[model samples]
Target: MFERFSDDERAIEGLPVRLVIALVVGIASLSVMMNTIGGLTALGVTELDVKPQPEVVAEGSNEITVTVITPEGEPVANATVVAKDGTATLSQIRPAKTGPDGKATLSLSPSLGPNQAEGTITLDVKPPAGGGYTDDRENTKLLVVSGGAQSS
Candidate 1:
């Protein structure tokens, strides 16, 4: 076999590895400093300058029952209901779907006070994207979770 190329001075190459390392380290250090400054700024800063006032709801006692009604003023069957309050919060509050009368009643055991208790019950629906069904609770109003109530 051949004895290989003579003392190969042209076989080696230089890449300035120090420059590459310095560039990478400089980028990393800049990122870390930016993250630290951002974290410090967010520690005590509020997102909004003016805090909106919450709606004043009536005081409620233990075990507050809720009935979910659909957009057409009809009760939504098999709809999930959630009830939350200041002291304690409940999830999947009740099971019993709507009956033939399209009415589902959800009762919260040992409820909470009027300290801004808000509950959101969502239902899953198919999206137009042709994908699997998506959550459509935001678009539907099964149960009213806001200030004031409709007088029957």
Candidate 2:
């Protein structure tokens, strides 16, 4: 059997409805994405300023005091401070938490490799939760000298 089709006018009855649904879905998704991005920025972010007392130390057992503060120079209390080996070798590092004065004392025994003149000990801070504090920036570093005397 052979049939001949007549082109009167092709009708797209459901095309507009499908297009409208897609448009609505797209707008809703965009709105949700924008809100999520806006929420992150709405949460205030604070930068940590870590400082190690006696910036330079001899290659031996020493007690270093670390202070955590905000950019506004306000001390950040109850924050955790961790000392890690950067270019130096650390014997053991016990993470310390800051007190009301935003100061934590850490006992670190750093050693330098043979023939190594100097090295660095890196410090990191973890601000208290819900404080909107960020520790992504560079922190203070401690200098460990092989033979030089420790500085106050």
Candidate 3:
């Protein structure tokens, strides 16, 4: 029994104090860790970052140069160019940005049916991540085709 732990005629038959203390400390440490992580997570620090959808610019154009210039009229490179018809959406047309001369070539697709609305061509420009802003060209340009060639 525990009474025999002294210099008696018996031996202690139980775990040592050090082992018990170690187990308790380990459990407490784990609990604190879990609580800290849970609390930090419960705060508004979720790992969900959503980006605002880029607005679509419908200045329809065929063989047009959409120069996504900066506030200082400097061209943007490696930017995303999307042309959409009011009826259907064209696949993301991401061509290389303008060269040092600030010029990019754009060739409009004539796949839409003559009657399928061909809707409208909206030009949405996602400028480079640095030193520029998104350009909402607005209803400025509209490419109207006539005689199988770009009219305006």
Top candidate, metric TM-score:
2
Candidate 1 steric clashes: 0
lDDT of 3: 0.47
TM-score of each predicted structure versus truth: 0.28, 0.76, 0.41
Worst 10 residues of 1 by lDDT: 46-55
* lDDT head-to-head 1 vs 2, winner: 2
lDDT per residue for candidate 1 within 63-113, as digits (tens), equals: 323344443354334444433333333433444443444443444332233
- In candidate 2, list every pair of residues with a backbone clash: none
RMSD of each: 13.0, 6.4, 10.8
Clashing pairs in model 3, backbone N/Cα/C closer than 3 A: 57-122, 57-123, 58-121, 58-122, 58-123, 60-143, 86-120
Q: Model 2, poorest ten-residue lDDT window?
A: 1-10
- Candidate 3 residues 1-152, lDDT tens each? 35554655433445466679999999999999999888753343211111111122232434656555554555556665555554444455434355454455566553454555334445555555653344543523333332343332
Query: Per-model C-alpha lDDT, please?
Result: 0.38, 0.89, 0.47
Better of 1 and 3 by lDDT: 3
